[model samples]
Target: MSDMEDCCDLQLCLDEIPSTFNLEKAVCNHGFFMMAPNSWIPSTKTLRRPLRLADFSASVVVSISQPPGPSSTVLLLRVHREQVIRMLRLSERDERNVKEFHKVHPEAKDRGFGRVFRSPSLFEDVVKSILLCNCQLSSKRKKRRQEKDGANPVPAEMEGEEVDLGNFPSPKELANLDADYLQSKCKLGYRTNYILKLAMEIEEGKLKIDGYEGVQDAASCRILIKGISGVGSFARASVLMCLGFYDEVPWDSETIKFLKHVHAREGCTKKTIKSDLKEIYDKYAPFQCLAYWFELLEFYERRFGKLSELSHTMYHKVSSSTQMREFNHNHVL
Candidate 1:
């Protein structure tokens, strides 16, 4: 019950840019901590190991405005300053790559795409990924309806009337919950069983869900997590990204589509996409490829709608800034 002071002048960072939504609330609700802001408790032994916000740097960049007008805003967060620098250099890395992406579709450059920031916690990243599984863009509305009807959606806080279940549940709590209880909380449909099994496995020490720093390789950790039930290729890749392991390629449906139409014209099988992504990014060290893949996907999504055919071309674009900005803009506004 000790108070943890705001070690960094995050407010200065916030003041430097104009965000359409509240960045502090977005970060908190995204589950950086269970308690409210300015009232942070010292991290538990387990939480301290995987969630390290203090070690990283974050920034918010708005594309439409130079000083960032109140209307259009882009928020970027990065764990390592070097990663942020590398992402900024992506536009310059290969003019051909940028132009080629645009040549296939002119609007690609206009689409405000690129890394905004990075977070240090794998826990936050993993939790956000779980919240996104099997859920369609339209289902968000349905979730609201369910909440209004007293469906008792997950116990997470509601930003206004909408439930903000994007935060990761505590491992202790998740491990203790039954399959039926979790389904009721998450409204996960068929994915409920998978979540329940994952929880139980993690709880039982069958899965090492935490303590990732000692692990040297992202692929090895991904392989371990993928062994858990309901942890598919997409989920495993996401877990890697969240943990500061940047070399993975998460192949969600949108990424699949983008590859087939935009990146690889001959039409891509899942195998080819994986191989090509690995080959194209092989020159970069493992994990660095993650940022590239993420930027590519974000560019695609921003230019096109969430469900657009172009979304499937790239891999690993699910950054917290994009998710938070979208959730706040759509739900809070």
Candidate 2:
């Protein structure tokens, strides 16, 4: 019998297998699962972002050990332990410092911010950043196209109609794709060239995501990722928080609006925001200021709907709801 079959038999003998052993179902319900020699371990965290979770799933499978080997038992356990640690976010995070950050951003209380989670592999994070470029939150056409192209749009689905875009593409898969094909699949407008360029660079080994692991220093990682094409300050900072272990203060439009409301400034510029993030994080060694920052933004969004009105005055016109729906229908179908 194959190692996987042996594992299954052992699980049955030990009565450790759960009644529900469906990988897809378990993953959808719990956000992630760790494949062990004799069991499938489920995570407690419900993935809020389905697409991101899908990416994590794909990447994890690749990194995990394969079945059908004598040593597979050891490999499976090691990989399972690692995956569990990642899913639970039970790595070297400083909880005390995170709580202090929440205290300062009182508005973000109980929002579940400051939970430091591992991001997918570097290649996946970079691709995700590229996908997000020049895209508005309400752009349905673009999102629908992504859905139709086999990308998981949501992390998990509540209803029959929802579609989950799986994780970002691997370097080998992405490198093989043409620019036009990527544009059509991702609905990447002017950013098509950037994605292609990034893929090529990664494939050629000029850029390496694995090298950035364990740095913990946000500034250093930010500078490293920013060197890639299409990765600007905002994208770099956000990706660093998600993938690299950097606790970054994301200075997106939403965050800027909240900062303006609280501080009464025109808004914090990218340079000023980056400086402030560095300064704030300096106090908490190895703790990220980003958790509090995300909490503050989520708090603002919950209290007051979209901060669209704030951006409307300062930025160009965004897509209307009707237009967004129409776009979603066409591409998603």
Candidate lDDT values, in order? 0.40, 0.43
Indicate which candidate wins on lDDT: 2
Expressed as tens digits, the lDDT of each residue in 1-333 for candidate 2 is 432332221211102222212122212211012101111211221222222223233322222222332222222222223333343333445344345555654433344445443333555445445544445655565455335534433212212233342333556666787878666654566666777788788779998766876666767887788778888766676577555354555466655665556655454775576665555455543435454445454454466443322211211122222222222222321
lDDT of 1 by residue, 164-186 (tens): 22222444556676777655444
Residue pairs in collision within model 2: 50-154, 50-155, 51-155, 55-167, 151-165, 152-164, 152-165, 152-166, 153-164, 153-165
Candidate 1 segments exceeding 4 Å error? 1-121, 131-168, 201-206, 285-288, 291-298, 301-333
**RMSD (Å) per prediction:** 11.8, 11.2
Error of 2 at 257 (Å): 1.7
Error of 1 at 29 (Å): 17
Highest TM-score against the true fold, candidate: 2
